[model samples]
Target: MMPMTITEIAEAVGGTVTAPFAGEHAGGVPDGEVARSATSDSRLVGEGGVFVAIKGERVDGHDYVAGLGAKGAAAAIVDHAVSDADVTQIVVDDTVEALGALARHNIERRRADAGKPFTLVALTGSVGKTTTKDLLKSLLSTLDETVAPVGSFNNEIGLPLTALTVNADTRYFVAEMGANHVGEIARLTTIAPPDIAIVLKVGVAHLGEFGSVERIAQAKSEIVRGLLPSGTAVLNADDAHVAAMRSIAPADVVWFGIDPAHADEDALTVRELTTDDMDHPSFTLVAANGDTADVRLAIPGAHNAMNALAASTVAHMLGMPLDDIARVLGEQRRISPHRMAVSTVERDGAVFTLIDDSFNANPDSMRAGLDGLARWGAGRKTQPYRVAVLGAMLELGGDEQGLHRSIGAYAAELGLDRIVAVGSATDAEFDALAGALAEGACTAIASRGGTAAVDWVHDADEADRLVTSIASEHPGTVALLKGSHASGLSTLAERWAPADPARR
Candidate 1:
């Protein structure tokens, strides 16, 4: 963040300085009294940091204003004034709006100071935004000082906080934009308009909120509409919904896809796609200029190959040679947690493979994860028994039950050795839907005379117990835990794969 005095901050956010220097002010807050960083969490406040007090569902940050002085905060931006704390206060009508205002000011300042104006690249999609953003950050950092969010920080609050982190030396700003409704992304574009926009795929991840696939497509395309006049739109040519966005983009369009049939002469295409025993995809990356490179990803999933192509297209446009782009992508490992994170655990003389893709789930991501697990199990020398401990995919709307059942049936069809559906067994309100998911898989398996077993558990504890028992009985068992945020599958993964002391 750029250094700004309390006076400058007040001017930027339309706030007033109220304490410590309210009456002692020599015209305005001293230029030396500056905040070097901004945060909404008081616990993260450092010396010379400005704390913005935001009221959340459970905790009101205004309640912590009295303690900022002890924590070395330079000033507090609050909706109300605090009398007890011996700290400078910037009183604004709304802290969130003030935060956006300050972020816009910082971005404008950085652009004016940059010798080469920093490029803003924004991406939105149903499933691959975070993973693709991580890949882009890794590739861009090889060429310039890049600023991208930590993990899944794509919403309103997270986006502005990320934008504010940019400074004069920052050359690339990669913003991951996400939305649950129609106008969310459009509002975000007003904060940090993109010079380049990427639309990965239009899927059913937020079907509940938007109500239909068409509405979801409309929400995702807001980023492209928000692009600058001279911006570049990098689109996924394979997705019909995403491909249609070319008509509305007000800038030059570049395409990336795995299927050659979807590619035009100017598109980056992937050919001869194949996965290794661990399910890591390798393919020939053919760029727009016909320069080709053999690319293999360290991440374990065939789905990630498409994400790699999206990142590679962005890197190629930014002047990274095709060979260098492939090398950087091939060397990159998992940057974010709980997305295709593979680990081994030894317990009671039994070794198990844990594929934890439990960060968030929808029908599309769930299918990709299951496919990766099936492939991985088939390629193992010992023929590891595959178990899927999946939680309910939330916010699927009126067809939620049907979608869950379809996912369950799909798992059975994959010939997985076992399936465990996680949900609240005791909660009468949730049992119907959760039970349907379990019954759907069991019925499908029985109908096909498949040997795969199905189990339904109320919570993560029961799911973990069942998985441990299966691993004990079958030493080479491999399990995939995929679920939405409410399922708490990520907590279970941490229990199974705690950090190793030797590696630490």
Candidate 2:
């Protein structure tokens, strides 16, 4: 974050400096001291950092204010004072509201100091928001100082924290907007409105929260609506719902997709796309100006091709050459962990290809991960055995059971050799959900009338044991682990892919 004087911070948040300077500078901090960064987590506070005390469900950050002095913190913004601690205090009515105010003030300061306004890019979708953001950040950093959120920090508090990190030197600010309900993205756009807004596909990611697919599309369209009058809207032409956003876009529109029907003079399109044995995609990137470059992504998955096109289109609009964009994308590896991460595991003289896409799951991503596994297994020289370890996909609302059943049936149709459904039916409240998934998968496999085996486990440990046994028996086995965050499938992936001693 850029440096801000203590006096300036208090004024930005409309708070008062009450301690450590009662008589100095009219009860304000000394003018020489500055806050280097802003964070709510006390553990991240440094000597010149500003700590915002927030009240959470399990813990109150006000309790941690007393220890900041020993940590060398510059000041703490809290709802109340801690008389026992020797820390400087900025008293505010609400710390969360103060945080937003401070971040907005910082952004305005950056714009004034930059002399020319910096570009603000906002992106939203049901899936691939993080991967596309990472790609855009990589491509933008080659040309200038870029600031993006770490992981999926795309919500209200997370978005504000990321905005505070920007300074005068930052030329590009990539804000990822996410929503589980309507108006969430609208609120985020008010904090830092986008000069360029990209809307990926609108799918059934948070169906439970929004109640229907139409509502999900309505929520995703808020990003396009929040754009500046002169902003550019980057949209996916293949998605009908996303394509319809052009009518509501306040500025110029740039379309991107693999379908030829969406191609135009100013569209960024893809052609002749194919995935390798490991599911890494390669395609010819054609710019609207007729310039073309072949892009081979290091990341594994056919679905990532669309993500690449989205990032490339944004970069092209920002004055990056087509060749440079393709070159940098080829050199890019996995930035965020647990999203279609491919690794080889050696155990008991057998090698298994592990596709760790267990970070989070919705119906769209679940289908994409399963397709990757099918393609990877089919491309093997010896025709390796295929195994799918799926867990419950939550936030699916009333039709959650039917959705889980359909996913199970789809996995069966993929011709996987084995299916392990991970969940327990022991809990009275969760039994219907878990039981439906397992029963649906088993029933589908039975209908196939093949040698493909299906098992239902109550926990990750049982699923891990079964998967280990399968890998041990079949040397060239390929396995996929996909589920929501609460399913504990990511933990199973970590157990398989332990830290390397050499890296440590």
Candidate 3:
């Protein structure tokens, strides 16, 4: 963060500074005393950095303030000052709000510096926010210093912490915005407004929280509405819900998609979109002004083409050539963990392929994972046995069962060798959802006279046993683990694919 004194930070957040150390002045620390960075976790506190003491559900950060000084922290921002803490304390009504205030102050300071101004790009969508951010960060960094969140740090606290990482040398700040309800992104946009906004596909990831798909689209469009008049809006033309957002866009719109039918007069388009045996894509990247380059993605899924195009559009807007954009895209092999990560496991003299996409799942991402698995199996020379070990997808509103059933039917339609539905045995509601998925596949297989097998396991342990049995029987098996984080599938994936580079 741009250096700010304890007095300046307290003033920006409307807080009171108290308990100046023995060597400090009477009115807080000296004017030269400042914090270089900010963090909510006390364990991450560094020398000359400020710590925000947040009160979470179980551990209150205020308890950790006593040890901040020994860790070389400059000061602590707390909701209430710790009595015996040696460090200077800035007391506020809420520590989370104070962190946001400090981040906003840091951004304003960078904008005010004429010699070191940075452009901020903000993006939000239901499924691909993190993946798109990762791709965009690599492309933007080719030009100059770029700051982006480490993972899916797109919520209130996450966005602010990422914004505070910007300093004088930073040229681009990629902000990934996420929301569970209406107006959440609007609140975040207020913290760090974007010079370019990207609106990816609006799916039903949070359908339960927002009540309807229309409401979900409304929430995603806030980024476009939040953009300044001079800014640009990079939109996906493939999704009708996202395409409809153009009507409400507050700035210039740039379209990007795979279909020529959806392309605007001068939109970014793709051709010959094909994937290899590992599901990596080789496509021709077409620019708005007729410039084209061949892009062969190192990432596993063909679905990532949209993500790559979105990132490339922003890079092109920033004056990067199409050839450079394609080259950078081909070099990004692995992204944040559990999103189309591929690995091989050896067990009892048998080797099998494991596609661990169990980080989180919604209907849209679930289908994409299944599609990738199908392509991987089809591309094999020997036609390997494919298995989909899927758990319940959460937060799908009243029709959650129907959605689960559809996913099961989709797996069966893909002709996967086996479908294993997994859920907690103790939780009847979740277990029933898993059963519905298995039942759907069973019915579909029966109707088509297909011999595909289906099973419903009680939990991840049961899934492991069943999968191990199948792998021992079928050595060339390819298995996929896809589900919401609550299902414990990602933990199972980590245990099996511990050496996968994406998880690291």
Candidate 4:
């Protein structure tokens, strides 16, 4: 973050200075005492960093402000001043809003720096936003310094905290915008407006909150609407809802997708797209200018082909060559945790491939993950025992049961050897949703003449026992873990494939 004095920060956030450090002046902190960064998490606060004390239901950040001086913190932004603490305090009505203001001030300072101007690229979607953000970060970093969020930090507080991390030498800021409502993305846009905006897809991830897919489309379009007048919009041409955004875009739009029907001379499209046995996509990245490069993504999933193309489009717009884009893309072997993350697991002398896509789930992403599983099984020399341990996909509106069942049917239709629908043992509602999934799979199996086994377990423990049983019986087995965050399947995935601490 650009350095800002305590007085400048308090003025930026409309806050009052209180609880000045003992060594500091009574009126205010001196100009030499400045905060170099901003963070809401007290544990992550560094010396010379400004801590934003946000009050949450479980934890009140104001409680930690009194100790900032001992940690060498420059100051604390809180709703109420902590008189006990020796650190400088900027008292405000709302610390979250103050953090946003500080971030906005930091970004404006960077933009006005003249010597080091940075391009801010923002993206939003129902799915693939983080994966695409990681891809774009990788591609952009190959050219110059880039800053992006840690994970799915795309909300109000997350976006601002990410924006504040930008410094003078940072050449690119890849902001991932996410919202369950119509105005959330627009609100975030006010904090860090993008020079180039991207809309990945308009799917049904947050159908319950937004009410309809059309409303979700409208919510996703805010990124394009929030772009600077001279900015560029990178949109997915494959999704009809996303494609329609071109009509409402505030600036020139650049299209990227796998579909040729939506492509024009200026759009980037994929050709001869295909995924390997592990679901790694290899495609010809074709540009509007006739420049082409063969891109073989190391990440697992055919769905990522569009994501890669979207990142390539942004890099291309930023003057990166197609060869460089392809090279950077191919070098990315992983993304944020638990999204189509592939690993090996051994249980009772049996081994299997684990596709840990348990980060979060929706109908679109579930189907995409199942497709990857089907391809992984089909590509093997010998047929591997395929099992899909699916948990309930939440926030799907009133048709939540139908959505769960449809996912089950999709796995059955894919000829998976086993379908385990997992739900909470203690939660009756989630158990019913899992039952619906199993019922759909059972119906599909009975009618389709497949020997697939469908079972609805109460929780991840039961699902793990069943998968381990299958692993013991079959030496070559492949398991897919897909679920919403509430389903807790990600925990099971972590147990199955614990992250390598050396790499972390």
lDDT values of the candidates?
A: 0.86, 0.85, 0.87, 0.87
Leading candidate by TM-score: 4
Candidate 2 per-residue lDDT, tens place, 1-504, comes to 778888889999999887653223234455577888999999999889899999999989988887676677788898887665556789999998899888878877876784756999999999999999999999999989999999889987899999989987889999999999999999888888889999999999989999999999999999999998999999999999999999999979989999978876788889899998878899999876678999999888899999989999889888999999999999887668788877777654666778888889999999999998888846656887899888888898889999888888888878889888888544433445556666777777787655677787777778777888899888788889899887777778888883431110
- lDDT (tens digit, per residue) of candidate 3 on 137-190: 999999999999988899889999999999989999999999999999998888
Candidate 1 local lDDT, 1-504, one digit each (tens): 888888899999999887653333323444478788888878889898888888999999888888676677788888888766556889999999888888888878787884676899999999899999999999999999999999998987888889888877899999999998999999888888899999999999979999999999999999999998998889999999999999999979999998898887777789999998778899999976778999988888999999999998898889888889889988877668889888887655667888889999999999999999888856656787899988878778899888888898999998889988888755653555667678889888878768888888887788777888899999778889898877667778878874441110
* Cα RMSD for candidates in order: 2.4, 2.6, 2.0, 2.0
| Per-residue error (Å), model 1, residue 432 | 3.6
> Tens-digit lDDT track for model 4 on 26-112?
346655787898888888888898999999999999888776777888889989877676688888998888888888898899999
lDDT for model 3: 0.87
lDDT of 4 at 130: 97
After superposition on all CA atoms, how large is the RMSD of candidate 4? 2.0
Look at candidate 1 and give me any clashing residue pairs: none
Off by over 4 Å in 1: 21-28, 425-431, 501-504
Deviating ranges (above 4 Å) for candidate 3: 20-31, 500-504
